[model samples]
Target: MPMKASGAADLTVVDRFDDGVGWIAYPDETMQRASHAVESDGQLWVIDPVDAEGVDDLFEEFAEVGGVVVLLDRHKRDAAAVANRHDVPVYVPEWMSGVEDDLDAPVKQMTDGVGDFAVDRLIDNPFWQEAVLFDGETLIVPEALGTVSYFCASGERVGIHPMLRALPPKKLRQYDTERLLVGHGEGLSEDVRQEVRGALSGARRKMIPLYLKNLRGALGI
Candidate 1:
């Protein structure tokens, strides 16, 4: 909930967590610790009291001084497990609560459209308030979600995470994206990044109509 020291060049490393929430750790690649950072709503959030073995190091590096927030871009992943552990509220779009059917992990939700809610202090005002970052701040996102496809039994449909891993250049020209964080899959690798970005971008556009249709029928709308 506070600020991290001024190590401005640190890039959170994106790693896969079995639980599905994206993990980004301090720049230290040597850390084989149970560490993870999540990009929720738009702010950077890290998990504390990390797995038993790496608890001390993980906690030391993760302590914040101010202006930190936890964002949960997808409710389906059930991220509250980590959010609750840190005693932080989860960020979400206003439209999301209308459709985030999962209840177990629900926490305080907010969006860029809100008139007042400490929104700016908590997250970036633009980018759907998506992919927020601050000096010495860290963010983790499912940068690959947009490209990866999965079958959902409940909705009987598939949807994308809206942001995918990709090169900063091509992604900007192709999407005119509001803003997003790199969560998983091949970070800083131009070739792998571009491929994943293109795939996810294409998939997200395709999944929109389908997701809406399925959600509408489910809600009787």
Candidate 2:
């Protein structure tokens, strides 16, 4: 699928935490794409950034951006553009080494961890590859996990992302996740751990159908 251009002027702050962690969402057709910024050690770090015209003003409100981190290879999104503007390094997961030849900023390899955050490869699929970020208390997931669909028939809009349902679940029960930050949708502030487990359980049974749907979506059929 072709990448969607970011409507930066349409970006808005959708969620904020007490620790200066914030999630921003920008329109992309009928759905919205999201990114996150967190304050750590007096600097701000952006994850899966989308290009925006007011990005400088946004960063100024937070602290100076220290760096940018890309969790999924396809999610490089506007990381290079944003990093160049800030003159910061762009960190990509070790698994995504050769996918960034077109990036303008300096790229660094993220090994087992970066700063105080640890990486967890949650999906084994090559096409739908993703990793979760554990920052001691919060779990930040890429496209592999989302709370936008009610696929589990829960009435509430929290469940596994359709594209990731075919993948087996990772053992994420150990994390004391107080907050759940996702790349494509809204963040969850309550009962995040339980919601994640529910999504995983729901995925196992609905895998086949979800896989077919995801494949069609990817093929734009």
Candidate 3:
């Protein structure tokens, strides 16, 4: 995927809900790198943020920036820049390591939860460490699941990450997710439970075909 800096003109607001708004900063990129600003207790918590020219304007009605949250190790994606801009610390889950070391802005390790969302550790290997933020109503899955075309299968609205499809994270199946927010593409508001369940249930069954499909796409077949 091509990585390029985006300006205000490139920002596209998506997944606008009652509690938060998501923005795609790099829409041209294959990844469709998305960022979220969730309002809890009158404070806006930015997640996996990608800095854009007028991102601050979206938070105007949501109250002040509570803090910036980084859910996955590699998704540092302008977190520090956004946190520093708002004068809030970058909140990394306590279990997630190495991410704080990479940030230039102030870092605060979250122990129990950040704002109203509780941290649920999804993957914890040496190479990848990720967690999802769930608050009974909203589910912010950073990587384990997404709505992007590359992440989903033939008729799926949400799909397991290609790397994790073989042995999909079963822990995610526990939640009856109402709203699904992700780091890539856009968030899902309708039929979230059905979409999430179908993705997990069919993940392994669809793995081989999906992998070959992605490989073909990569080779421009």
In terms of lDDT, the poorest run of 10 residues in model 2 is 148-157
Off by over 4 Å in 1: 1-44, 47-59, 65-75, 98-106, 113-186, 189-221
Candidate 2: segments with Cα more than 4 A from true spot: 1-8, 21-25, 150-156, 206-221
Q: Score candidate 3 by TM-score against the native.
A: 0.95
lDDT of each: 0.33, 0.69, 0.89
In model 3, what are the clashing residue pairs, if there are any?
Answer: none
Model 1 over residues 1-221: C-alpha lDDT tens digits? Answer: 11122233243434433221333333333221223443334433543212222322333343331112333333223244544545554445453433244534444454552111122222223342333332222222332222112211122222234332221223232332222334322222234334435444555444555566546655668
Across 1-221, the per-residue lDDT of candidate 3 in tens digits comes to: 56444454388899898889999987878888889999987788999998887899989978789999999999998999999888999999888888988999999998877778988888999989998899989999999998887898888888999999888998988988889999988988888988898999999999988888888988989
Evaluation by TM-score, superior candidate among 1 and 3: 3
Cα displacement (Å) at residue 165, model 3:
0.8
What lDDT score is found at residue 170 in candidate 3?
89
Residue-by-residue lDDT tens digits, candidate 2, 28-107: 43345678877666778888887765656666667778889888767888889889988999987777645468677898
Residue 131 lDDT (model 2): 70
Q: What is the lDDT of residue 201 in candidate 3?
A: 97
Give per-residue lDDT, candidate 1, residue 35: 33
Give the candidate number with the greatest TM-score.
3
